[model samples]
Target: MPMRRLRPRPALPSRRKAAATVVAAALVGGAFVGILSLTGTPHAPSARAAEGTGAGEHVRAKALPADAHGKSGKPGRPVRGVRPPVSVVQIVAHPDDDLFFMNPDVSQSLHSGNPLTGVYLTAGESDGVNARPRDAKAAAPDKAGYAEARQNGIRAAYAEMATGSRTSPWDRSAIPTKGGGWAELDTLRARPQIRLVWLQLREAGSVNGDRPYSLHGLWNGRIGVLASQRAAGTPVPTDFAYTKEQVVATLTGILERFRPTFVRMQDPSPGTYPKTGRFRDHQDHLYGARFVQSALARYAELPGHPHVGVQNYLGYPTSVLPHTLDPETADAKLRTVKTYAWLDGVHDCGTDAGCGDLKVAARPGGRGWTQTVRYARGTSTSWVQRDRDGGLHAFSVLDGRLAAWRKPADAVAWRGPELLPGGGLDSGVTSVTLPDGRIAVFGTRTTLGDSATDYRREVVTTVQDEPGGGFGPWLSLGTPEPDDASGTSDISAPAVTVAPDGLATVVLRDSRHRLTAREQRTDGDWDPWRPLGGTDVYGDPVAATDAEGRGYVFASTPKTVLAWAAQSPGEPLAGPAATGLPPTTLALSASAAPDGEGVRLWFRKPASGDLRSADFSGTGPVSPVTELPGTGVAGYGPVSGGDGLVAVRSRTGFLATAPHGRSGSRPVWTLEKFLFSGAPDAGTDGVAAIGLDARLHWTPAGR
Candidate 1:
């Protein structure tokens, strides 16, 4: 989230980073989504006024059918009681951080049905008065009162987004944190699913300033105990202090209680001006996100905890990149920001954080920069999948829609670029082969409402009309957490495969970031959505079928990999059972293990991003993870074939390949001149990726 600049304060001496582990970066985008539903879940269905009644009024969702043009248009059945299962916890340094950095997503998730929890690390006691300087000259600053008012404004905005009313009453209470201090927690009265937690700690007075007693000081070893800047209306008896370890422990405790599938915070790696050497984001934002990252590691290691994904947003500098959000999505984001600012001259919150930031409320649409969002380190793996006939079928999101291409076993060059129909699809899609040889293209569709803010992301698929021809119209498999579209960014790209009975099974990360699956029956109808029981899964899922035709789906957490296997065709999937492997990049590749009873998983190790592998044979234990000895390998692969063909990137970002298959083998990876993004498709034909120039580049395995 961007830091709202306060009045010109004295510039304090700049201190260097506190620790070497701090991921000081401009962008490190890893795909994570939060599901929103039609109810109080992150995605609210309508703008119904909050009556403060415990029973929330439901907004019926509109169903869009295909028009004559084969695109979304005609009205189908409206999905009611469609509650999404995902939850989101947003950690920011101040009140407006989410608005400035993570909206559109925030608005979308809330509209979809993912429950939300926002944690504000500081009280944001900026100059303390709710009024402007010109009007507050005669009044003393009320830090406590001002903080309360700001929180009230936040409650109003959150209520409106989740329940369509700013006056949604909140049950506020004090909760004890592991840090040995009391933090304020608020729950929505009508929609008990939404929550807010306030740490109410002191804010730094200046940008790039170092304090011996603030979050920065604690992070850097300059402070032993930091005192609280309690919100006056909070239900704590006495003010308390927190040590550095205590603070980390306390955030960790909050995470344990929430068990959030998705976690978001401001940029942890906020570098400084190149020439001036000044920090980019606020000291609190950088340090606060770092603490959260540290807490996440601890949380992930806990025995019995669910898998959780983390998304670190870009700070101020994102403005310079190309506008990533659609115009409608961007507009919806600003509207929410305006709501938080209370820009419509509304005073519904009644308490002091003084409705909202009047300064920003007066100018809700800040410079065009606020409309843009970008992520760092996005490695887009290819969507190329090989079918039984040895023909290649590939899918990509072209011009905001799903596009298809084919290469026949008897043909030389790839076939026509057949554009399939699906709207609001993310940048990529996945495809799988059926037992009959026809290919099925699967994707997460984004259905947009009249207002961009109202959106939905659902699992969708379409089969090839003829063996090597264009695909049929899109089929809506529907989301388990069918939301009104407050948000659905948490949904992952699909990992699909076919069962022995010719049934098509598609697996993907649900709105809740869990592994979920749906299968097409003999009648060509899809089964209802259900969880495969894995957590913290990210990006595109990877699936492989053993010799028995039992399908194995693998999902990568920030630190570990989990697999769910199919018992039989037309039967429920089981076993998100742990693979007992160490952490990997959110990306991974899986192929049937040579033993025919298990699967081989390939991924890059964290910290070094070195390509590594372990064999899972559905036996007693997985083999010890062995490093695929190589230097300068920055990412994992589009791993394919029983004889694995791996893709790797150099430390300098050039892409290349390495072979790893035979037992006890240590093949070396050499850097090539090709500059590629996404995974390289490796098969009997070759490896392919979108080059730096944005064109698909193909390299034969012989090279």
Candidate 2:
């Protein structure tokens, strides 16, 4: 599509002067209390009153009632008997964070005919210039005006995505937050189910610089309160501030009111560069997500809340990785960015702030951001396991608990995504079958203490007391890293293997990109964690057993794959052998070889989603690699299943499956329409995935 051009509207002298005064006062004392119209025209009270409920009700920040800070109610207490409907709430740091990191999924949710709410924590008023650096007519630093323009652009983009029209009208108003501040709420007139909320808090301004006024500083207690930067035309009549506790309370209150069934946020632990020790993502994206994490923890304790599933999206780091979307999906995503960037230069939104974010118009794709979307966690392929009796069991972390689903050996239907008792479980849960037929589930858990310094992520597990029975209490397997400050809690999800003698080993990649392991002794006690010796290891590790009863663990670096193996059934693992494998996309999965002699490793070619595999005997040179025949479909993430069937993500961000190992007959991939979380799991009986709607979806064998 070609960019459109339109005539610019003349600036109104009175409104322009008022905006300049507001900016000057803000710079003088680091506080802003003035209000100015961004559109050069005052909002009519009649128009606001006709929009929606509470549209014209404006409240001053100084007059909030004392009861506004009331508790979110008792923990684990249900006030309603019926479960709430499926609703999604995405909390992000800035306007485009969701568009850049969570799209395709965001668009799919909008199209699902369910309610979706987007909450932006920051004003995104970077440098306050609404034009490219080269633009001669770039506006001066007016933070409030710039923020308002970005909000306008986001509204246009969301309206077009939901109602197929960029000019869709919205009912804009102010809502008093549970945090003692007012947030701007906008609801699309055409689709009342879609909403956008702006917290209007000050942005960090720099990508990684240490700014004490930003969320990072507030989180670390370097600042007492983070002040708001109300947009020029926001319905919120006055500015306010939020303490760390107040921010969490606000989010918890939102959760209680909206009661969303799924939540999306940026990655709190995006890790750091191994060489420079710089953050891999914007500091706001990281620390802002930490606040969301805290809120979710508090909300989980409140009464009458629906079960929620969460997915974290990768931000700036995705630019360096392989693109995950196919051309068609990428193009669709780019169109939305163009709308938000105001690339067409059409001033149709009736705003003197220019309708969209002009600064983004210079480079709408955001340094390759528009072309890819990747999950920061929950991509493990070991989530499914077959029991000794031919039953299949799948596990996923939902609502801070273990959600288990099972299909009996003789039954045609899958039943019970029954959540096990306990909380604090993070995304991604892997399972392994014990020698006695019992199953053990492994995952990482986050603990949000009263202080920021107490935030931590640790490995935890629960196993069935007996085969096909209930699970025991969650057992903690302390993290190898000292704390969140030094490591940013960048540990990978646990990958486990159980030996023939009933000894189990759990392997994980730590913050320093090295492998660490904790083994289970024959007495049922765990050993202290120790380094396994691998460098630059990225992504989660995978473990599997061979026909000879030896266990192997594998992880990937940017260059090649690394392997460690146990010599015997219950021996210590040794060697970080260079497998001589070509560079992969850092996604790996393993299953028993059809010949019953060794284990087969599956991975994707870098930048090319074609499947590749090789057989490994755990302690020797690897076998020659073989490429699976292509079916014109390509996507990232670990591919599951062996010779009988395979499940993978298709180019369209949907689940797909095909028959494997059929000679002379090309595999035909059948695609599912829904988007799903984590990776797909396949067995001889069927394939399964956790849908984005937080439910289990199954495709039986031979369908």
Candidate 3:
């Protein structure tokens, strides 16, 4: 009777236009937002905060404002960011864009519990089929045994999301993809920090009007006729022909073997827009987002590449839109991938892949499934630190602009490329920080029109540190202006914290999707945006603050997965509940509790790909949630060293975690190895510090 308590929300709304159209229709319905939580709520228990009323002040006096400058009401100010160790890797392209576009940043870097690995890149064999559901001898079988039954249905869904028991059995191995051709690779192993590698290939073709092998004849600049296999021999075994630079050198040799920081693909933009019908997305998601942007520009000219982060998802018809799930932390990510039973066959769920070929087989008349959905990368990022000298930073934004990412070794006398001054980054730059030390960076910068709700505005770029330290060039808080027209405004991708008096609270998702909270008046300015309101969830809103500074924001909508409070100094927050997530979600990050608890949210469940957690307990709600193993394609893990740790650069090498207590959620250390071949510089002491692989390892925070 779960499915969110047999579907309760009898019309909830209210948390500011349901947080901008249900977290922008569950991020453009990717992973079909897990079939929009297949109707899940029966666990109850949540909903509390009401006595002398002060769970934090019932939505900050009505969503905050009065000049709202730095406290996120914004007038000016800015500043600085990790968790990482070794033994972890994740390289994605299909089989659940790493469970919803590299989810919860690959389930908060596998709960920092370490030892993880994943690399799929196609055997996502499309319709020729496999995640089961095809009867008549499996519909039309023999496409190389339905590509080995969709590689044993993603090895029983990554052995039931990394070892919960999917019967554990894969070890295949055929490898070699960049032109020499071969493809087969599969490995599952339940523990020792998990593992899954697939490699299949083939999918591509389809520009919208699918018919005669399309992706517009293999990425409009036609190269190997879109994943050649022409003669459609069925399920790529290759007659030994390749060349799209040998399939981008068999995906740049799986990115020089596990050199991933975050890379999730699909939606390469020309999904066919000419008349607009099929161009909304798909063509093996635009040749897998242009072959992972030409294998990350050849993994940044090889020689040790790994500080990479990319996510894109959204195909089919973006599922009519609106379902969102940050309902105060979507029931702690629905208790980390639970529900699936739904009364009968759920495909029997024994081997763990527990059936979810986009869902439907729950039995009793069935028909509820909606294309086994999985879309990701609608932009949701995290990274922090503003002062203290160690410098190291990044606040992220893509497709909407507002960037920042510093490190050239951060200190110990480092040297080069962290500079990126103003010039309006223009695309979706979700969030960035420096709240009090002074270099802020929030995102979303497109205005002119054409969907994304015609682009409203919520930018906020700042950088003014010099006097003896470093950064000084950028500035633009400019009066909450961002209205580009306001179709309810649509905002997420902004989360900054900084209190203890220095001011700065910033958390986002406005246009009334609520979760607002803008306060920065110690003289810095920003004051009018208020409303830590509640109800509605799905995220791209992450915030952190502890060591006494107070604040916390988290979010993730659709009806649960929450966190929002302030607790003191003029208070006004503390009312929002439920956090039992996991029915398929990806994107939500938080960390600021260095040793114990105050804030710690991170997600990713794409049905059972795993990686989940919860902690923030100022009164009740968020706790007891856990699940960790591996899966990441983008959410660009690693970058946050304000105290409690977080760092992830997967493909199976370099992981970090800290999470802490309430007795559930795990990961206090998991490192895999030389995590990032290039990008990584965490060290708020928990140390992640990477850049050019050379094989390093330190991984330990676990206990």
Candidate 4:
């Protein structure tokens, strides 16, 4: 049945008339011509989405997000020199999952000096032997021995990332999680802050674990006690079995301990029970991630949990796609994987779990994953923030430097490739207009050492003292993981909300994936970084101001959307209670609800790549989630809004804009070839995209 939503609560009277006129004229040819007509400017063909395109090709509103010509509007090949600010904690099914599916990203994080922690769910004892194929004297299958070897390989690779030596010693210790399980923690002796936690659970051993001996069994209620398979040569002698509930609690305990701001997980949506085809990940990878998802959900409900962000990687699935990583990045990723594969001679760590997986060693270049990296939800996470004037500014990281471009409030021509006063800023950026009109840019910036092993990432900021004025020097807002010996931490792009009185609160996901914040006091001083308390928030933070000038913050977890709002401006923030939204893609766009009664949220339904939205009036329950008109590969990105206009991009790389409430499933203005940085700033002059060609693509306001 064709779903009928309440026609997006009709626009205001005069604007409604303008829309009616547009519809009347547009009905003659199609919504395309009608929308273009509203702009009252000649439309040009779009070719710069991915690969450059020629002009004169007609772009239309009714078309899907991607161009039929194969211009997918993917973000320009990622700028190579910059580092990611995201502190990453990858929880995977085996020792090499990070190398295989989460490459480049894993390597990039380490190389950029971001604090990283890897959690392995199982021993990965496929044949249970830790021997290279070329070694004729290799031992027979011994799960414990093989697990130890894998751990050795992982440690070597991680140590190299931290201190430039594969054989760097580690301080191995057993830590008890809140869920009543003991985990092996290996902290690098050279870099004590970076560590690996091994749970050493038994593997399912097959795609379908019908025997009830696997994570699948535990998740499906087929098994209550999943036993631990301890790795060899470990000082901790005891082993234990966990009930289904205990497993989730165990994972949750780890989350609480690590408190990752961003969690990298294998895709958990396997689509069907008897998994088939591309959408399915390994059963363990799928279910193990499901366990993590379960943990995140449970953790989020805790009163004082940190906001955790999540990013899911397409495992095995990435092997078939075109390479997403640049050659340099991919090659760097391969080297790290090769280390885990023990491509270099193995270090004889005396134990049952041998040096590393020989199968991967024999083919260390890797089947598919080592050569590329793909985010299940698509990447281009940069945002473009705007202010009250018609003028708009776009910010991005170019060659590790924060770059800015501004379209003057009164003119259409964009100007400035102006570099902000910092070189180590993270790739994507977040900006907020202060109450005084100064634009403040917030991001987790990285300081690259002379070598890949020397790096430090922290949340920092720089703001324009006045609109269109020069920006002050990059300012230190500080990092969440300040005292970690590694000196690097995972923090999400900032979500800074400015109140009418000019009070601003900066929200971020700490290394633990917990939501933390720092607010500006009336004395012009900022508060210390502190947890505001929410969990499993695996995406960028978003916020909007209510009529009362109170700020409301929202974040998405694997299961649902959670929100926290200030009872009043400058008051301690409260209530990250559930907002009643369903599972959503990590990306979200939000604005003040048109009715002034609540806030409206725009996001993609996970995996569906369909636009979805919901509204919550502070007085009542959230409105039902409604699907918007978008079905594509990338899902949705950041959104920009102002002066009653809102703009967004579908995952399929389409550009869309509409009057505040009027953009539901059907947006009023769409340009199919409009691929851009996720952040779109809308103002009286028009809607604009920081083009893939590194130019500003602007369309005049429809009304």
| Candidates, ranked, lDDT | 2, 4, 1, 3
Error of 2 at 237 (Å): 2.4
How close is each model in CA RMSD to the real structure? Answer: 22.8, 18.0, 23.7, 17.3
Instruction: Judging by lDDT, tell me the better candidate of 1 and 4.
Output: 4
lDDT by residue (478-523, candidate 3, tens digit) is 2243442322233554666555454566666554455666676767
TM-scores, all candidates, are 0.47, 0.83, 0.30, 0.50
Clashes of each: 47, 0, 170, 34
lDDT of 4 by residue, 1-703 (tens): 1211112222221111101111111111101110000121112324432222111111221111112221222222212222112245779999988878866455445654556789999878766756666762566777787778888888877877667878788889988866687889888776665879998889987765355788877776677788998988665569988877888888888877776645778765433212232223577987787677667666655544322345566676444334444345556678887888877664565544555676678878666676555454323222455555646676665334565656555643444445555565554666666656677777766553433233345778887777668788888887766532222244566876666667778887764557998988889789898898876556567665544455667776767767776654557566566655666656666654444333445565443334454543222222344444342222234454444666665333456666554333323444435334335666444565544333344555652
Best by TM-score: 2
Tens digit of per-residue lDDT, candidate 2, span 72-133: 11112112112124688999999988888899788878886789999999999888888876
Ranking by TM-score: 2, 4, 1, 3
Candidate 2 residues lying further than 4 Å off, grouped into runs, are: 1-85, 136-138, 274-277, 593-598, 615-629
Once superposed on the true structure, which residue ranges of model 1 sit more than 4 Å away at CA? 1-382, 387-390, 410-412, 415-418, 484-489, 593-598, 617-621, 624-630, 635-644, 668-672
